[model samples]
Target: MRLLVMLTCLLAGCLAEKPHPCESPPLLTGALTVSTQNEKLWTYTRFMYDALGQRIRLMELGTYENKSFSHDVLALFREATMYEISYHNRTCKKKPLKTDFQPLAIPKDATLLGQAVLGSSSGPGQGLLVNTWTGDLPGKAGKYMNTVTEFGCIPIATSYQTSEFGWAVTSFFNNVIGIEDPGLLNPPDFCPDAEMMDSKVEPIDFLSLFHGKA
Candidate 1:
Protein backbone atom coordinates (compact mmCIF):
# COMPACT_ATOMS: atom_id res chain seq x y z
CA MET A 1 0.00 0.00 0.00
CA ARG A 2 2.81 2.39 0.82
CA LEU A 3 4.59 1.87 -2.50
CA LEU A 4 1.32 2.01 -4.42
CA VAL A 5 0.37 5.44 -3.08
CA MET A 6 3.82 6.75 -3.88
CA LEU A 7 3.37 5.77 -7.50
CA THR A 8 0.03 7.53 -7.64
CA CYS A 9 1.70 10.63 -6.25
CA LEU A 10 4.20 10.59 -9.07
CA LEU A 11 1.47 10.46 -11.68
CA ALA A 12 -0.55 13.05 -9.80
CA GLY A 13 0.72 15.95 -11.86
CA CYS A 14 -0.29 14.48 -15.21
CA LEU A 15 -3.94 14.10 -14.21
CA ALA A 16 -4.02 16.89 -11.61
CA GLU A 17 -5.73 20.28 -11.99
CA LYS A 18 -4.35 23.62 -10.89
CA PRO A 19 -6.53 25.84 -8.76
CA HIS A 20 -8.09 28.83 -10.51
CA PRO A 21 -10.84 31.16 -9.45
CA CYS A 22 -14.24 29.98 -10.51
CA GLU A 23 -15.92 32.07 -13.22
CA SER A 24 -18.70 32.59 -10.72
CA PRO A 25 -19.57 31.39 -7.27
CA PRO A 26 -21.16 27.98 -7.34
CA LEU A 27 -24.93 27.86 -7.65
CA LEU A 28 -24.94 25.96 -4.40
CA THR A 29 -28.70 26.27 -4.18
CA GLY A 30 -29.57 24.97 -7.63
CA ALA A 31 -30.85 21.90 -9.35
CA LEU A 32 -28.35 19.19 -10.37
CA THR A 33 -29.14 17.22 -13.54
CA VAL A 34 -28.29 13.59 -14.08
CA SER A 35 -28.86 10.92 -16.75
CA THR A 36 -30.73 7.66 -16.35
CA GLN A 37 -28.75 4.93 -18.00
CA ASN A 38 -25.01 5.19 -18.64
CA GLU A 39 -22.77 7.54 -16.71
CA LYS A 40 -21.05 8.53 -19.96
CA LEU A 41 -24.11 10.16 -21.47
CA TRP A 42 -27.44 11.59 -20.39
CA THR A 43 -27.57 10.20 -16.86
CA TYR A 44 -31.11 9.73 -15.62
CA THR A 45 -31.85 12.10 -12.78
CA ARG A 46 -34.67 14.04 -11.07
CA PHE A 47 -33.91 14.80 -7.47
CA MET A 48 -34.29 17.65 -5.02
CA TYR A 49 -31.68 19.35 -2.88
CA ASP A 50 -32.07 19.93 0.81
CA ALA A 51 -32.67 23.30 2.45
CA LEU A 52 -28.96 23.62 3.18
CA GLY A 53 -28.18 23.28 -0.49
CA GLN A 54 -26.82 19.84 0.29
CA ARG A 55 -27.92 16.70 -1.50
CA ILE A 56 -29.30 15.18 1.66
CA ARG A 57 -32.57 14.04 0.14
CA LEU A 58 -33.56 12.29 -3.07
CA MET A 59 -36.51 11.38 -5.28
CA GLU A 60 -35.80 9.22 -8.28
CA LEU A 61 -38.16 9.61 -11.23
CA GLY A 62 -37.50 7.25 -14.10
CA THR A 63 -35.33 8.37 -16.95
CA TYR A 64 -37.05 10.43 -19.64
CA GLU A 65 -37.63 7.13 -21.34
CA ASN A 66 -40.00 6.67 -24.25
CA LYS A 67 -42.86 7.54 -21.93
CA SER A 68 -43.30 3.88 -21.05
CA PHE A 69 -43.75 2.26 -17.65
CA SER A 70 -41.87 4.73 -15.45
CA HIS A 71 -39.84 3.79 -12.41
CA ASP A 72 -38.31 5.64 -9.50
CA VAL A 73 -34.59 5.78 -8.75
CA LEU A 74 -32.81 6.92 -5.63
CA ALA A 75 -29.57 8.80 -5.25
CA LEU A 76 -26.80 6.65 -3.86
CA PHE A 77 -24.02 9.23 -4.01
CA ARG A 78 -23.77 12.05 -1.54
CA GLU A 79 -22.75 15.68 -1.97
CA ALA A 80 -19.67 15.97 0.23
CA THR A 81 -18.03 19.27 -0.74
CA MET A 82 -19.11 22.21 -2.87
CA TYR A 83 -16.36 24.81 -3.39
CA GLU A 84 -12.76 25.10 -2.31
CA ILE A 85 -10.89 27.83 -0.44
CA SER A 86 -7.41 26.90 -1.53
CA TYR A 87 -5.14 24.08 -2.66
CA HIS A 88 -4.75 23.19 0.98
CA ASN A 89 -7.60 20.77 0.30
CA ARG A 90 -8.16 18.04 -2.29
CA THR A 91 -6.72 14.53 -2.49
CA CYS A 92 -7.95 11.18 -3.80
CA LYS A 93 -9.94 9.44 -1.13
CA LYS A 94 -12.25 7.36 -3.27
CA LYS A 95 -11.27 3.75 -3.84
CA PRO A 96 -10.92 2.42 -7.35
CA LEU A 97 -14.17 1.54 -9.09
CA LYS A 98 -13.30 -0.70 -12.01
CA THR A 99 -14.84 -0.52 -15.45
CA ASP A 100 -14.26 -2.83 -18.43
CA PHE A 101 -13.95 -0.19 -21.15
CA GLN A 102 -10.66 1.62 -21.60
CA PRO A 103 -10.85 5.37 -21.91
CA LEU A 104 -11.37 6.03 -25.64
CA ALA A 105 -9.94 9.56 -26.01
CA ILE A 106 -6.40 10.43 -25.01
CA PRO A 107 -5.08 13.98 -25.15
CA LYS A 108 -2.47 14.60 -27.79
CA ASP A 109 -1.05 17.52 -25.86
CA ALA A 110 -1.15 16.80 -22.13
CA THR A 111 0.44 20.06 -21.00
CA LEU A 112 -2.61 22.18 -21.85
CA LEU A 113 -4.48 22.31 -18.56
CA GLY A 114 -4.30 21.92 -14.78
CA GLN A 115 -1.28 20.12 -13.34
CA ALA A 116 -2.62 17.98 -10.53
CA VAL A 117 -4.82 14.91 -10.48
CA LEU A 118 -7.58 14.12 -8.00
CA GLY A 119 -6.56 14.33 -4.33
CA SER A 120 -3.27 16.03 -5.08
CA SER A 121 -1.66 17.41 -1.98
CA SER A 122 -1.32 21.15 -1.42
CA GLY A 123 1.60 22.99 -3.01
CA PRO A 124 3.60 22.48 0.17
CA GLY A 125 3.45 18.71 -0.14
CA GLN A 126 4.03 18.75 -3.87
CA GLY A 127 7.58 17.93 -4.85
CA LEU A 128 9.11 19.31 -8.07
CA LEU A 129 6.00 17.81 -9.74
CA VAL A 130 3.15 18.23 -7.26
CA ASN A 131 0.27 20.77 -7.64
CA THR A 132 -2.76 22.01 -5.74
CA TRP A 133 -6.32 21.29 -6.95
CA THR A 134 -9.41 23.04 -5.79
CA GLY A 135 -13.22 23.42 -6.14
CA ASP A 136 -13.42 20.11 -7.94
CA LEU A 137 -14.67 16.68 -7.07
CA PRO A 138 -15.67 16.54 -3.45
CA GLY A 139 -13.82 13.48 -2.20
CA LYS A 140 -15.35 11.19 0.32
CA ALA A 141 -15.80 12.79 3.77
CA GLY A 142 -15.48 16.23 2.19
CA LYS A 143 -11.74 15.72 1.85
CA TYR A 144 -9.76 16.07 -1.36
CA MET A 145 -8.10 13.15 -3.15
CA ASN A 146 -5.78 12.95 -6.08
CA THR A 147 -7.95 12.43 -9.15
CA VAL A 148 -7.30 10.45 -12.31
CA THR A 149 -8.15 12.29 -15.52
CA GLU A 150 -9.45 10.92 -18.81
CA PHE A 151 -6.04 10.77 -20.42
CA GLY A 152 -4.34 9.74 -17.20
CA CYS A 153 -5.63 6.47 -15.81
CA ILE A 154 -6.42 5.46 -12.26
CA PRO A 155 -4.00 3.07 -10.57
CA ILE A 156 -5.06 0.01 -8.72
CA ALA A 157 -3.77 -0.11 -5.14
CA THR A 158 -2.31 -3.55 -5.01
CA SER A 159 0.45 -4.41 -2.56
CA TYR A 160 2.41 -5.97 -5.43
CA GLN A 161 2.16 -3.12 -7.95
CA THR A 162 4.62 -0.23 -8.36
CA SER A 163 4.29 3.05 -6.47
CA GLU A 164 2.92 6.48 -7.56
CA PHE A 165 -0.14 6.70 -9.80
CA GLY A 166 1.80 3.98 -11.73
CA TRP A 167 4.56 5.66 -13.72
CA ALA A 168 8.31 5.77 -13.63
CA VAL A 169 9.90 8.46 -11.44
CA THR A 170 10.44 10.57 -14.59
CA SER A 171 6.92 10.31 -16.09
CA PHE A 172 5.40 13.57 -14.96
CA PHE A 173 3.30 15.18 -17.72
CA ASN A 174 5.23 13.43 -20.44
CA ASN A 175 3.15 10.32 -21.14
CA VAL A 176 0.26 8.88 -19.24
CA ILE A 177 1.01 6.68 -16.24
CA GLY A 178 -1.81 4.30 -15.27
CA ILE A 179 -4.25 4.82 -18.14
CA GLU A 180 -4.10 1.94 -20.58
CA ASP A 181 -6.50 2.83 -23.40
CA PRO A 182 -7.94 6.33 -23.51
CA GLY A 183 -11.69 5.97 -23.21
CA LEU A 184 -14.42 7.72 -25.24
CA LEU A 185 -13.53 10.61 -27.45
CA ASN A 186 -16.93 12.10 -28.27
CA PRO A 187 -18.79 11.13 -25.17
CA PRO A 188 -22.49 11.81 -24.82
CA ASP A 189 -23.19 15.07 -23.01
CA PHE A 190 -23.85 14.30 -19.37
CA CYS A 191 -25.91 17.34 -18.57
CA PRO A 192 -24.54 20.65 -17.26
CA ASP A 193 -21.84 19.18 -15.06
CA ALA A 194 -18.50 20.91 -14.96
CA GLU A 195 -16.60 19.50 -17.89
CA MET A 196 -13.12 18.29 -17.03
CA MET A 197 -10.78 20.44 -19.10
CA ASP A 198 -9.69 18.43 -22.12
CA SER A 199 -5.95 17.78 -22.03
CA LYS A 200 -5.64 18.42 -25.78
CA VAL A 201 -6.89 22.05 -25.54
CA GLU A 202 -4.90 24.69 -23.70
CA PRO A 203 -6.57 27.29 -21.51
CA ILE A 204 -5.68 30.92 -22.25
CA ASP A 205 -4.24 31.18 -18.76
CA PHE A 206 -1.90 28.32 -19.44
CA LEU A 207 0.98 30.75 -19.10
CA SER A 208 -0.17 31.59 -15.61
CA LEU A 209 2.14 28.87 -14.45
CA PHE A 210 4.97 31.38 -14.80
CA HIS A 211 3.01 34.57 -14.18
CA GLY A 212 2.43 36.37 -10.90
CA LYS A 213 -0.43 35.35 -8.67
CA ALA A 214 -3.97 36.08 -9.80
Candidate 2:
Protein backbone atom coordinates (compact mmCIF):
# COMPACT_ATOMS: atom_id res chain seq x y z
CA MET A 1 0.00 0.00 0.00
CA ARG A 2 2.84 2.40 0.77
CA LEU A 3 4.49 1.65 -2.60
CA LEU A 4 1.21 2.40 -4.40
CA VAL A 5 0.86 5.74 -2.54
CA MET A 6 4.45 6.73 -3.42
CA LEU A 7 3.91 5.93 -7.08
CA THR A 8 0.74 8.03 -7.17
CA CYS A 9 2.50 11.03 -5.61
CA LEU A 10 5.39 10.80 -8.06
CA LEU A 11 3.01 10.60 -10.98
CA ALA A 12 1.13 13.64 -9.84
CA GLY A 13 4.31 15.59 -9.49
CA CYS A 14 5.43 14.62 -12.97
CA LEU A 15 2.08 15.61 -14.45
CA ALA A 16 1.95 19.02 -12.86
CA GLU A 17 2.05 21.86 -15.39
CA LYS A 18 4.36 24.80 -15.16
CA PRO A 19 2.97 28.30 -14.95
CA HIS A 20 2.90 30.41 -18.08
CA PRO A 21 5.34 33.26 -18.24
CA CYS A 22 4.27 36.86 -18.55
CA GLU A 23 4.07 38.50 -21.95
CA SER A 24 7.00 40.58 -23.13
CA PRO A 25 7.30 44.06 -21.72
CA PRO A 26 6.04 46.98 -23.79
CA LEU A 27 9.40 48.72 -24.07
CA LEU A 28 12.69 47.05 -24.91
CA THR A 29 16.07 47.59 -26.48
CA GLY A 30 18.09 44.76 -27.92
CA ALA A 31 20.59 43.63 -30.47
CA LEU A 32 19.81 40.79 -32.86
CA THR A 33 21.64 39.02 -35.65
CA VAL A 34 19.46 38.06 -38.58
CA SER A 35 20.24 35.67 -41.42
CA THR A 36 18.06 35.02 -44.41
CA GLN A 37 18.24 31.97 -46.60
CA ASN A 38 16.83 33.46 -49.76
CA GLU A 39 18.97 36.55 -49.75
CA LYS A 40 22.01 34.79 -48.33
CA LEU A 41 22.41 37.87 -46.18
CA TRP A 42 23.49 38.50 -42.63
CA THR A 43 22.60 41.62 -40.71
CA TYR A 44 23.53 42.88 -37.25
CA THR A 45 20.92 45.18 -35.86
CA ARG A 46 20.29 47.21 -32.72
CA PHE A 47 16.66 48.00 -32.13
CA MET A 48 14.44 50.10 -29.93
CA TYR A 49 10.86 49.00 -29.54
CA ASP A 50 8.03 50.97 -27.95
CA ALA A 51 4.81 49.05 -28.06
CA LEU A 52 2.90 51.77 -26.25
CA GLY A 53 3.91 54.34 -28.84
CA GLN A 54 3.47 51.95 -31.76
CA ARG A 55 6.98 52.58 -33.03
CA ILE A 56 10.25 50.77 -33.64
CA ARG A 57 13.65 51.77 -34.90
CA LEU A 58 16.40 49.60 -36.34
CA MET A 59 20.02 50.35 -37.13
CA GLU A 60 21.20 47.65 -39.48
CA LEU A 61 24.60 46.85 -40.91
CA GLY A 62 24.71 44.03 -43.39
CA THR A 63 26.34 42.44 -46.42
CA TYR A 64 24.26 42.03 -49.53
CA GLU A 65 25.34 41.15 -53.05
CA ASN A 66 28.85 40.79 -51.71
CA LYS A 67 29.01 44.41 -50.56
CA SER A 68 28.56 46.07 -47.20
CA PHE A 69 25.57 48.34 -46.58
CA SER A 70 24.15 50.12 -43.58
CA HIS A 71 20.83 51.83 -42.93
CA ASP A 72 18.51 53.06 -40.24
CA VAL A 73 14.79 52.46 -40.36
CA LEU A 74 12.07 54.08 -38.34
CA ALA A 75 8.70 52.41 -38.49
CA LEU A 76 5.64 54.24 -37.25
CA PHE A 77 2.82 51.75 -37.21
CA ARG A 78 0.16 54.19 -36.06
CA GLU A 79 0.92 56.47 -38.99
CA ALA A 80 1.44 53.59 -41.42
CA THR A 81 4.73 55.11 -42.50
CA MET A 82 8.34 53.98 -42.63
CA TYR A 83 11.46 56.03 -43.06
CA GLU A 84 14.62 54.46 -44.42
CA ILE A 85 17.68 56.59 -44.04
CA SER A 86 21.27 56.20 -45.17
CA TYR A 87 23.48 58.48 -43.18
CA HIS A 88 26.46 57.59 -45.33
CA ASN A 89 24.83 59.23 -48.31
CA ARG A 90 22.59 61.64 -46.46
CA THR A 91 19.57 60.19 -48.22
CA CYS A 92 16.22 59.01 -47.01
CA LYS A 93 13.11 57.44 -48.42
CA LYS A 94 9.63 57.71 -47.01
CA LYS A 95 7.31 54.91 -47.88
CA PRO A 96 4.08 53.33 -46.72
CA LEU A 97 4.47 50.82 -43.95
CA LYS A 98 1.79 48.27 -44.62
CA THR A 99 2.74 45.68 -42.04
CA ASP A 100 0.85 45.79 -38.79
CA PHE A 101 2.59 45.83 -35.47
CA GLN A 102 3.34 42.41 -34.02
CA PRO A 103 3.87 42.33 -30.31
CA LEU A 104 6.70 40.31 -28.83
CA ALA A 105 4.49 37.92 -26.94
CA ILE A 106 3.80 34.41 -28.08
CA PRO A 107 0.46 34.01 -29.73
CA LYS A 108 -2.37 32.52 -27.66
CA ASP A 109 -2.65 29.65 -30.12
CA ALA A 110 1.03 28.75 -30.14
CA THR A 111 1.89 25.13 -29.47
CA LEU A 112 4.41 24.49 -26.76
CA LEU A 113 7.21 22.49 -28.31
CA GLY A 114 9.61 21.98 -25.43
CA GLN A 115 11.48 23.56 -22.54
CA ALA A 116 15.09 23.57 -21.41
CA VAL A 117 17.74 25.49 -19.59
CA LEU A 118 20.13 27.60 -21.62
CA GLY A 119 23.24 27.12 -19.50
CA SER A 120 24.70 25.08 -16.66
CA SER A 121 22.08 23.75 -14.24
CA SER A 122 24.23 22.15 -11.59
CA GLY A 123 23.10 24.67 -8.96
CA PRO A 124 20.12 26.80 -8.14
CA GLY A 125 19.57 29.72 -10.56
CA GLN A 126 22.55 28.62 -12.54
CA GLY A 127 20.86 28.78 -15.89
CA LEU A 128 18.02 30.48 -17.66
CA LEU A 129 14.89 28.47 -18.36
CA VAL A 130 13.30 28.91 -21.75
CA ASN A 131 10.32 27.60 -23.67
CA THR A 132 10.02 26.79 -27.37
CA TRP A 133 6.80 27.41 -29.23
CA THR A 134 5.69 26.82 -32.81
CA GLY A 135 2.79 28.22 -34.73
CA ASP A 136 1.50 29.16 -38.15
CA LEU A 137 1.47 32.85 -38.86
CA PRO A 138 -1.87 34.55 -39.21
CA GLY A 139 -3.62 34.12 -42.58
CA LYS A 140 -1.35 31.16 -43.21
CA ALA A 141 1.39 33.51 -44.28
CA GLY A 142 4.17 31.42 -42.80
CA LYS A 143 5.36 29.30 -39.91
CA TYR A 144 7.47 30.30 -36.94
CA MET A 145 9.29 28.80 -34.02
CA ASN A 146 10.33 30.95 -31.10
CA THR A 147 12.35 30.37 -27.99
CA VAL A 148 11.85 32.81 -25.14
CA THR A 149 12.92 33.06 -21.55
CA GLU A 150 10.43 31.40 -19.25
CA PHE A 151 10.48 34.08 -16.59
CA GLY A 152 10.56 37.31 -18.56
CA CYS A 153 9.20 36.05 -21.86
CA ILE A 154 12.06 37.78 -23.65
CA PRO A 155 12.82 36.39 -27.07
CA ILE A 156 16.04 34.46 -27.33
CA ALA A 157 15.75 33.21 -30.86
CA THR A 158 13.29 32.91 -33.69
CA SER A 159 13.17 30.98 -36.98
CA TYR A 160 10.48 31.56 -39.49
CA GLN A 161 9.62 30.91 -43.14
CA THR A 162 7.47 32.89 -45.47
CA SER A 163 6.40 32.27 -49.03
CA GLU A 164 7.73 35.61 -50.15
CA PHE A 165 11.00 35.85 -48.24
CA GLY A 166 11.83 32.22 -47.56
CA TRP A 167 13.56 31.31 -44.29
CA ALA A 168 15.16 33.55 -41.72
CA VAL A 169 16.63 33.06 -38.30
CA THR A 170 17.18 35.78 -35.75
CA SER A 171 19.09 35.44 -32.50
CA PHE A 172 18.55 38.04 -29.84
CA PHE A 173 21.11 39.16 -27.28
CA ASN A 174 22.12 42.09 -25.06
CA ASN A 175 18.48 42.77 -24.30
CA VAL A 176 17.67 45.56 -21.86
CA ILE A 177 14.34 45.99 -20.09
CA GLY A 178 13.38 49.50 -21.22
CA ILE A 179 14.07 52.09 -23.86
CA GLU A 180 16.65 54.50 -22.53
CA ASP A 181 16.38 57.11 -25.29
CA PRO A 182 13.05 58.00 -26.80
CA GLY A 183 14.88 59.95 -29.51
CA LEU A 184 16.02 56.64 -30.96
CA LEU A 185 12.54 56.24 -32.43
CA ASN A 186 12.69 59.45 -34.36
CA PRO A 187 13.62 59.67 -38.03
CA PRO A 188 16.86 61.38 -38.87
CA ASP A 189 16.94 65.07 -39.78
CA PHE A 190 17.37 64.17 -43.46
CA CYS A 191 14.05 62.33 -43.40
CA PRO A 192 12.19 65.61 -43.76
CA ASP A 193 13.64 65.92 -47.25
CA ALA A 194 13.26 62.23 -48.02
CA GLU A 195 11.90 61.17 -51.35
CA MET A 196 8.23 60.38 -51.09
CA MET A 197 7.59 57.05 -52.73
CA ASP A 198 4.32 55.96 -54.30
CA SER A 199 1.88 54.16 -52.04
CA LYS A 200 -0.16 52.11 -54.51
CA VAL A 201 1.73 48.86 -54.17
CA GLU A 202 0.74 45.67 -52.41
CA PRO A 203 1.77 45.16 -48.83
CA ILE A 204 5.26 43.80 -48.36
CA ASP A 205 6.67 41.33 -45.87
CA PHE A 206 8.29 43.39 -43.16
CA LEU A 207 11.46 41.34 -43.15
CA SER A 208 11.96 41.98 -46.83
CA LEU A 209 12.86 45.54 -46.03
CA PHE A 210 16.04 44.32 -44.37
CA HIS A 211 16.99 42.50 -47.55
CA GLY A 212 17.09 45.81 -49.49
CA LYS A 213 13.90 44.88 -51.26
CA ALA A 214 11.96 47.94 -50.20
Candidate 3:
Protein backbone atom coordinates (compact mmCIF):
# COMPACT_ATOMS: atom_id res chain seq x y z
CA MET A 1 0.00 0.00 0.00
CA ARG A 2 1.07 3.65 -0.51
CA LEU A 3 0.92 4.31 3.23
CA LEU A 4 3.29 1.42 3.99
CA VAL A 5 5.82 2.64 1.42
CA MET A 6 5.80 6.15 2.90
CA LEU A 7 6.54 4.86 6.39
CA THR A 8 9.40 2.68 5.13
CA CYS A 9 10.99 5.70 3.37
CA LEU A 10 10.76 7.76 6.57
CA LEU A 11 12.36 5.03 8.60
CA ALA A 12 15.26 4.67 6.15
CA GLY A 13 15.94 8.39 6.29
CA CYS A 14 16.04 8.34 10.07
CA LEU A 15 18.40 5.38 10.18
CA ALA A 16 20.95 6.75 7.73
CA GLU A 17 24.09 8.13 9.32
CA LYS A 18 25.82 11.28 8.12
CA PRO A 19 29.57 11.66 8.30
CA HIS A 20 31.17 14.87 9.57
CA PRO A 21 34.65 16.15 8.83
CA CYS A 22 36.87 16.88 11.79
CA GLU A 23 40.37 17.99 12.70
CA SER A 24 42.32 17.19 15.81
CA PRO A 25 43.40 19.89 18.21
CA PRO A 26 46.49 21.82 17.10
CA LEU A 27 48.30 20.77 20.25
CA LEU A 28 48.05 17.52 22.14
CA THR A 29 50.01 15.13 24.32
CA GLY A 30 49.42 11.41 24.20
CA ALA A 31 50.81 7.93 24.64
CA LEU A 32 51.17 5.62 21.69
CA THR A 33 51.71 1.88 21.33
CA VAL A 34 53.12 0.94 17.94
CA SER A 35 53.58 -2.50 16.44
CA THR A 36 54.69 -3.63 13.03
CA GLN A 37 53.54 -6.53 10.91
CA ASN A 38 54.06 -10.04 12.30
CA GLU A 39 55.08 -8.54 15.62
CA LYS A 40 58.47 -7.70 14.22
CA LEU A 41 58.72 -4.51 16.26
CA TRP A 42 56.99 -2.96 19.23
CA THR A 43 57.33 0.40 20.90
CA TYR A 44 55.76 2.54 23.56
CA THR A 45 56.05 6.22 22.83
CA ARG A 46 55.06 9.34 24.70
CA PHE A 47 54.65 12.32 22.46
CA MET A 48 53.96 16.05 22.52
CA TYR A 49 52.65 17.36 19.24
CA ASP A 50 52.49 20.97 18.04
CA ALA A 51 50.95 20.79 14.60
CA LEU A 52 50.62 24.55 14.27
CA GLY A 53 54.24 25.05 15.30
CA GLN A 54 55.57 22.20 13.08
CA ARG A 55 57.33 20.49 15.95
CA ILE A 56 57.07 17.30 17.97
CA ARG A 57 58.89 15.49 20.74
CA LEU A 58 58.87 11.78 21.36
CA MET A 59 60.28 9.50 24.00
CA GLU A 60 60.33 5.98 22.71
CA LEU A 61 61.03 2.69 24.44
CA GLY A 62 61.20 -0.15 22.02
CA THR A 63 62.12 -3.80 21.65
CA TYR A 64 63.65 -5.04 18.42
CA GLU A 65 65.53 -8.28 17.76
CA ASN A 66 65.06 -8.98 21.44
CA LYS A 67 67.05 -5.89 22.35
CA SER A 68 65.41 -3.12 24.39
CA PHE A 69 66.35 0.51 24.04
CA SER A 70 65.12 3.94 24.91
CA HIS A 71 65.63 7.27 23.23
CA ASP A 72 64.21 10.75 22.84
CA VAL A 73 63.72 12.64 19.63
CA LEU A 74 62.94 16.26 18.93
CA ALA A 75 61.92 17.19 15.40
CA LEU A 76 61.88 20.86 14.41
CA PHE A 77 60.33 21.02 10.98
CA ARG A 78 60.75 24.73 10.53
CA GLU A 79 64.44 24.40 11.22
CA ALA A 80 64.72 21.21 9.14
CA THR A 81 66.60 19.52 11.95
CA MET A 82 66.14 16.58 14.27
CA TYR A 83 67.94 15.68 17.45
CA GLU A 84 68.05 12.12 18.74
CA ILE A 85 69.22 11.67 22.28
CA SER A 86 70.13 8.39 23.94
CA TYR A 87 69.85 8.66 27.68
CA HIS A 88 71.45 5.30 28.32
CA ASN A 89 74.57 6.14 26.34
CA ARG A 90 74.52 9.88 27.09
CA THR A 91 74.82 10.53 23.39
CA CYS A 92 73.09 12.80 20.92
CA LYS A 93 72.93 12.87 17.14
CA LYS A 94 71.80 15.80 15.04
CA LYS A 95 70.62 15.27 11.51
CA PRO A 96 68.47 16.89 8.90
CA LEU A 97 64.73 16.34 9.11
CA LYS A 98 63.74 15.84 5.51
CA THR A 99 60.08 15.04 5.89
CA ASP A 100 57.46 17.77 5.88
CA PHE A 101 55.10 18.27 8.76
CA GLN A 102 52.02 16.15 8.34
CA PRO A 103 49.10 17.66 10.22
CA LEU A 104 46.98 15.59 12.55
CA ALA A 105 43.84 16.49 10.64
CA ILE A 106 42.07 14.01 8.46
CA PRO A 107 42.82 14.53 4.78
CA LYS A 108 40.10 16.24 2.80
CA ASP A 109 40.15 13.43 0.24
CA ALA A 110 39.80 10.74 2.89
CA THR A 111 36.99 8.24 2.50
CA LEU A 112 34.70 7.56 5.41
CA LEU A 113 34.66 3.87 6.18
CA GLY A 114 31.92 3.86 8.83
CA GLN A 115 30.79 4.88 12.26
CA ALA A 116 30.66 2.74 15.37
CA VAL A 117 30.23 2.90 19.10
CA LEU A 118 33.23 1.91 21.22
CA GLY A 119 31.29 0.75 24.24
CA SER A 120 27.86 -0.14 25.47
CA SER A 121 25.15 2.31 24.37
CA SER A 122 22.39 1.10 26.62
CA GLY A 123 22.27 4.39 28.56
CA PRO A 124 23.42 7.99 28.53
CA GLY A 125 27.23 8.45 28.62
CA GLN A 126 27.60 4.74 28.10
CA GLY A 127 29.38 4.68 24.76
CA LEU A 128 31.88 6.60 22.70
CA LEU A 129 31.08 7.24 19.06
CA VAL A 130 33.89 7.09 16.51
CA ASN A 131 34.46 7.38 12.79
CA THR A 132 36.95 5.55 10.62
CA TRP A 133 38.66 6.99 7.56
CA THR A 134 41.09 5.79 4.94
CA GLY A 135 43.34 7.65 2.54
CA ASP A 136 46.58 7.60 0.60
CA LEU A 137 49.72 8.99 2.07
CA PRO A 138 51.55 11.92 0.55
CA GLY A 139 53.07 11.21 -2.87
CA LYS A 140 51.20 7.94 -2.86
CA ALA A 141 53.99 6.56 -0.75
CA GLY A 142 51.57 4.41 1.19
CA LYS A 143 48.05 3.97 2.48
CA TYR A 144 46.66 4.80 5.91
CA MET A 145 43.55 4.09 7.90
CA ASN A 146 42.67 6.00 11.03
CA THR A 147 39.90 6.25 13.56
CA VAL A 148 38.91 9.27 15.58
CA THR A 149 36.25 10.24 18.04
CA GLU A 150 33.04 11.61 16.55
CA PHE A 151 32.95 14.53 18.96
CA GLY A 152 36.39 16.06 19.57
CA CYS A 153 38.28 14.37 16.72
CA ILE A 154 40.68 12.76 19.11
CA PRO A 155 42.64 10.04 17.37
CA ILE A 156 42.06 6.47 18.50
CA ALA A 157 44.22 4.37 16.20
CA THR A 158 46.07 4.57 12.90
CA SER A 159 47.65 2.03 10.59
CA TYR A 160 50.07 2.55 7.74
CA GLN A 161 51.60 0.33 5.08
CA THR A 162 54.13 1.27 2.49
CA SER A 163 55.92 -0.38 -0.38
CA GLU A 164 59.31 -0.01 1.22
CA PHE A 165 58.19 -0.84 4.72
CA GLY A 166 55.64 -3.30 6.04
CA TRP A 167 52.48 -2.25 7.83
CA ALA A 168 52.42 -0.77 11.32
CA VAL A 169 49.62 0.00 13.71
CA THR A 170 49.62 2.71 16.35
CA SER A 171 47.06 3.04 19.08
CA PHE A 172 46.65 6.33 20.88
CA PHE A 173 45.52 6.73 24.49
CA ASN A 174 45.66 9.04 27.47
CA ASN A 175 45.39 11.95 25.10
CA VAL A 176 45.21 15.42 26.62
CA ILE A 177 43.87 18.30 24.56
CA GLY A 178 46.79 20.72 24.92
CA ILE A 179 50.43 20.74 25.82
CA GLU A 180 50.98 21.59 29.48
CA ASP A 181 54.54 22.82 28.92
CA PRO A 182 55.96 24.16 25.69
CA GLY A 183 59.43 23.54 27.01
CA LEU A 184 58.96 19.84 26.42
CA LEU A 185 59.62 20.43 22.75
CA ASN A 186 63.02 21.90 23.36
CA PRO A 187 66.07 19.74 22.76
CA PRO A 188 68.04 18.78 25.84
CA ASP A 189 71.10 20.81 26.89
CA PHE A 190 73.38 18.04 25.67
CA CYS A 191 71.95 18.31 22.17
CA PRO A 192 74.23 21.25 21.50
CA ASP A 193 77.16 18.89 21.69
CA ALA A 194 75.51 16.31 19.46
CA GLU A 195 77.44 14.77 16.64
CA MET A 196 76.42 16.60 13.53
CA MET A 197 75.77 14.23 10.66
CA ASP A 198 76.27 15.15 7.01
CA SER A 199 73.25 16.97 5.69
CA LYS A 200 73.61 15.30 2.29
CA VAL A 201 73.25 11.86 3.80
CA GLU A 202 69.87 10.22 3.51
CA PRO A 203 67.80 11.29 6.46
CA ILE A 204 65.25 9.24 8.32
CA ASP A 205 61.57 9.95 7.82
CA PHE A 206 60.10 11.74 10.80
CA LEU A 207 56.96 9.64 10.93
CA SER A 208 58.74 6.43 10.15
CA LEU A 209 60.76 6.69 13.32
CA PHE A 210 57.77 5.54 15.31
CA HIS A 211 57.18 2.70 12.86
CA GLY A 212 60.33 0.95 14.06
CA LYS A 213 62.43 2.24 11.22
CA ALA A 214 64.86 3.91 13.60
Model 3: number of clashes? Answer: 0
Misplaced by over 4 Å in model 3 are 1-17, 87-91, 193-195, 211-214
- The sequence of per-residue lDDT tens digits that candidate 1 reaches over residues 1-214 is 9999999998996776654322111111122333222222122222222222212112223322233222221111222211111112322111111112112122222222344434445667453332222222112222222322333232211011112112111111222222222121111133124333334533222111111111
Provide the TM-score for each candidate, comma-separated.
0.18, 0.85, 0.85
Worst 10 residues of 2 by lDDT: 200-209
lDDT of 2: 0.83
Candidate 2 regions exceeding 4 Å error are 1-22, 88-90, 193-195, 200-203
- Quote the lDDT for 93 in model 3: 80
**Can you write out model 2's per-residue Cα lDDT over 5-41, one digit (the tens) per residue?**
9999999999988746347889999999888777767
Candidate 3 lDDT, 48-103, residue by residue in tens: 99998889998899886567867688899998888887767767788888888887
What lDDT would each prediction earn against the true structure?
0.24, 0.83, 0.83
